[model samples]
Target chain A: MIGTLVQTPLYQWHVDHGARMVEFAGYSMPIVYTSIVAEHTATRTAATFFDISHMGRLRFDGPDAARFVDHLVTRRTADMPAGRVRYALVTNEEGGVLDDVLVYHLRDGAHASYRLLVVNASNHDKIARWVDVHRRRFDGQVEVSDLTNSWSMLAVQGPNAAELLASLVDCDLASLHYYTAAETRIAGKGGVISRTGYTGEDGFELIVGANAVVDVAKSLMEAGKNLGIVPAGLGCRDTLRLEAGMPLYGHELAEEINPLQAGLEFAVALDKPEFIGRDALVAASERTDVPVRVGVELSGRRIPREGAEVFLPAGASPIGGVTSGTFSPTLQRPIAMAYIDRSHAEVGTELTIDVRGRHEPASVVALPFYRRPSGRESTS
Target chain B: MKPEDLLYATTHEWVHVAADESGGKVATVGISAFAVESLTDLVFIELPEVGRQVKAGESFGEIESVKAVSDVYSPVDGEVIEVNEVLRDDLERLSQDPYEAGWVAKIRMSDEAALAELMDHTAYQKQCADEAH
Candidate 1:
């Protein structure tokens, strides 16, 4: 038997719905809910809900709270409004990514409600240790707490997501906007709804009482039936992010890689007075000859998988390696991401993917293979 | 599900030796119901190179579903005579009638002795039963 551990909060629900469960990030997550394609298309068109409770949510509070967090994390939390969220990467001393997390400068507190620092599930222990060591140095300023077990997180995403969720929450979910969070009541729970998601769609992440998760999941599924809310599995989550050109930890972000090489220079604020790994990030950016991550779209259906070599047009040898590759349901073709030597990283540059022994032709395209409709109204 | 007069392979291929529209032994090969179920969505299919020579139990082509990539193995020894070109473009046919309209390839038996080597319906059923657990 191909047995892998890690059970999600909805493990039993997954089996009942014919989901093929696989262990990911120490949890047996449903890689597919009903069908991968159906779920992917559903998220693009309507809405989908995902149980991301497996992610780690940490909280920090005290007088020096903002500065303590700003010193270690990429985004300057001191200037961030209470209701807003920021996408940032926490780095090691060597400037490599420790983990990519969304800092929701939440309004909630024990008295004021709460604020959440959502980290990747696999990096919870590592991040907790990092916080403990950093907190000692800034002891009087703030106190760090890991609250991953206190809540269940459901990501409701797609075009019509706001309309579907507004009926359940007490507040106007549509007014929350993107990258912002708020304290609200949903399904009779003290909920923290963040206007954020991995899928590139108009969405919200609902953090509710851990015990009341199943009630919300089932209710949302029933309410959004006509609105097309799919109970997406992790498989759809991966493909959707891939299409939107988002980076995953194991694939795009890793301890050995940094923001400069990962095409995440925009998130790294070099001017942020001082923070961990800033010096190393500067040195990496100065190297013009350094390789940059690029997205590759294969011409054929033969999907180039990870560890596949990329043979640049003018290079004597393979210039880079594939980080992630999938047969895109949106594009109806194979798409892949690779970190090529600086010379071949330019967009529109053609390249060949070494699949086993044969060469499959491809072109370097813009990062995201697909784009979801954003909340900002366009002039056109 | 087709009538169990023929044999099935672990890989989900079924082989039936029936007299062609003409005379010589022709092996009509298709994927089994279990194989069709295993590979849910029928995407791009690489048909066996028509008229190409192939050995018994060798991989003739490839099939891709949403979740996995699977190689379609040959059931018996034969030379590739024809392929279902219709199913190549419209893969949904495989999900519909895997044993009939969804047939993959046809072969001219290279050796008459190879036909008897395949498992019959009863033996193939037993093999499938043993694997379920």
Candidate 2:
């Protein structure tokens, strides 16, 4: 019998490369290699590669596919231009988050109408089953295939990421705007490259077919060696994203939280006719007492990790708990994201985070804590 | 690493025993270099307040790394006399020189007999080896 756990193609490579292994998202992923700070700095200054094959990828096709998926998601799939990508949260019927996914519309004059939905690895089977169960509701024309087992993914991130990738691929990387994606070849193998990332860095997420992923990743690593490209693990990935105030699944988004409360209001298309969670989200927006997702910078070096209590402004009782925290290399301090009372979510509001036992002071701050302007300006 | 003249704990704690100016036995305890290497990049430390009572084999405080949190157990039953407060800001001292600047706490042993129960240098090293395998 097969083990319940799965390892990516580069599992042995990670062990060989001195990765500190840990289980995350159901895969034995590298949480760190040597030091998280080193890998984080590499991504910000130059480039770093990641094994994100654990994340699930499913393909949808057929004539009425676009229209069918439009009903399935809050975003209007029919409106998505070919060779583009958009971030959307898949919600359950009760308005709870099913998963936050990036949809790739690959209708670049191809005869087939196909869209690739990339989802969190932990919720792969759950999302696949959910989509299958709801397939008939999508106007009975769209066919869904769980390509999760047949695909591997990599994300090369850094300010210099585009330069390295563009040098390797003949495609004009400068034309690609943030949130846009395209189907291209790397070393003569085809894959989808998207200009989106978990870390707030300029990067490309290359989705390779199962067979080609390993070779593509190896080539990218070799090509980026002089660029200080390190093989980053999930530990640095978490710290880097948290520094940029990105919400992680299960930490910031969960089955109990809707997009509105999680501060993902822009992703929810309220103007769209009807979708899952529309009614509940409408009612949810009316509630003034709903909690909000906010960022906090710890005063001291002591980091307030997940489950640590977050005391609100002054002597008031703790209104929330830390969802994720770490010593960010860029910010050079302990940064965290937590869900707290809307009253206490205002930027610059002082609070205390009880890190283990001591009350470490913190302050609420605006999100996307680090932003690097794209070399290519958005024409939109 | 700080060399504790007293017997050591198999959990990697070095205990130094000395007769106080009074008749009571005083034990200064801290983690060994091997333990510090096992836990890299210390982020924060929670040490027991001075004058707090602790039993032998009981946790006096904890040190947190990016990876895990490990409790520092008292080697002998006693009252906390002093704590390494300076190490709070500079936790690398534990990995740098666990024996001296990394001393976790000093305690006045309530029962001097507790020292007899701990392992000596050679035995503690063997225990550390056995546990790892």
TM-score to native of every candidate shown: 0.90, 0.89
Which candidate ranks first by DockQ, i.e. highest?
1
Estimate the lDDT of model 1: 0.80
Residue B54, model 1, lDDT: 79
| Alpha-carbon runs more than 4 Å astray in model 2 | A1-4, A108-111, A313-316, A373-380, B1-28, B32-35, B48-52, B67-70, B79-86, B97-101, B112-133
Candidate 2 lDDT tens digits, A1-380:
11455788878878888886777777888888867777888888889999899999988888777765666566666788887787888888778998989888885436465888999998898988888887856556788888777777889998878877986675778888888887778766777788888888888898778788777877888888878888998877887788767788899999998889888887888788887777777778788797899988876777778898998647658888888877767877788899898988999999998877778889998886776565533323
Q: Write the per-residue lDDT of candidate 1 for residues B49-96, one digit (tens) a residue.
A: 888777777888888665556788887777889899998678888877
> Which pairs clash in the backbone of model 2?
B1-B99, B2-B99
The clash number for model 2 is 2
Model 1 regions lying over 4 Å from their true place? A1-4, A109-114, A136-138, A313-316, A374-380, B1-6, B19-25, B111-133
Residue-level lDDT of model 1, residues A143-206, one tens digit each, is 7787788777889988878888878888876567778888888876778887888887778899
lDDT of each: 0.80, 0.81
